[model samples]
Target: MDPDVAMWLGSTLLTIGALAVGVTVHLIGLGRVAPTFALGLPGRRLRTDAATFALTHRAATPLTWLAAAIAAVAAVGALAAGLGTGIGEWAVLAVLSAIVLVIGLTLATWRAHTALGDDALLDDSTNGPLRPGAD
Candidate 1:
């Protein structure tokens, strides 16, 4: 097979995979299922119905979108790299895309955690805690 054609095919596959993974992650993060239950095993129960869940979902929405954006960009990069002249460029693009994927996810999770943090919830003097017993 021609190198360029092979590269393009590889890029297309990567793009599809990235999109699948990104969408899956976003759906999981935005879901209301209990984390332990999601893992398919019994574990400590958490307040899944709390206000924190809503807040976290709202906070995470943008992050998930950002992740999607990153994935799209990666896809574009892959496509462009495949069309470009050098194999070295393709390698670089692959590494960069991987880095971007990791970084985007890390930032998204971090932001969501901060937004739904105990302090953030506690600071809401009007609504107070989501659960009556929750600290």
Candidate 2:
């Protein structure tokens, strides 16, 4: 397996996993997108406070976007350079990128989670009349 292949594979896998989580969480509770994303991935319950959910969603939204971008770039880079290399090298890069992505992404999520409050307000408030009841 080429390094590029490995990189691409690694990136693809991570993105898929991350996006899958995103979609699943979104489906679980569209109204509580922020809290579900912050807590659900690790297995936690969503808070009932609308303000709290909005705060975290706003805070984490940027980081989450960045992480998604990073993952996409890393994957593309991996795929591009992996055309004719061994898996070992790609694996190394993949592992490193994965670590960084996870760390950075998790920090973003945590910040968003911690900053949430019962009265915080955000433009993209994840809480609204539609939140209380969902599929």
Candidate 3:
């Protein structure tokens, strides 16, 4: 196969991967279940099992968007440099996606903790000094 054709094919695959990620994120963000959910588990629990799921899902929105952008640029690079179909191209995009995911998760966790803290004051009279409760 011609190098140009191979490169083009690689571009196609990258585009497909990026598009897949984008559509998946949109559907999930919009409250639409991903296709994989149906095949993975029952009761749709996988999608909304955690109390922090909504928060995580919200966080995933930006990461996936960013992932697509990174992947698109990476694909173009691969296509132009004849680096398509190479691990280097895939790895670059994968690493970017991973970075985005990790940062997004970290941010989400922090945001959730801040937004939904325990907010409960325990009766620490036993541990702390008496507060005139006469206990």
Error of 2 at 6 (Å): 6.0
**For every model shown, what is its TM-score relative to the native structure?**
0.60, 0.59, 0.50
Worst 10 residues of 2 by lDDT: 126-135
Could you give me the TM-score of model 3 versus the true structure? 0.50
Q: Write the per-residue lDDT of candidate 3 for residues 1-135, one digit (tens) a residue.
A: 765666677677766767566566555444455335532112242344332233334435565566566666666665655453565565555456445544544553354334333322123544422211122
Model 1, residue 119: distance off in Å is: 7.7
Q: Across residues 94-117, which tens digit of lDDT does each residue of candidate 2 receive?
A: 666576568756876675556544
Candidate 2 residue pairs that clash: 2-85, 3-85, 4-82, 5-82
Which candidate, 2 or 3, would have the higher lDDT against the true structure?
A: 2
lDDT of 2 at 77: 62
TM-score of 1: 0.60
Worst 10 residues of 3 by lDDT: 126-135
Off by over 4 Å in 2: 1-8, 19-51, 117-135
lDDT per residue as tens, model 1, 1-135: 776776677677767766765565444444543343342111122225444544454455566567656766776776686576566677678667767766766776666566655465564666564442244
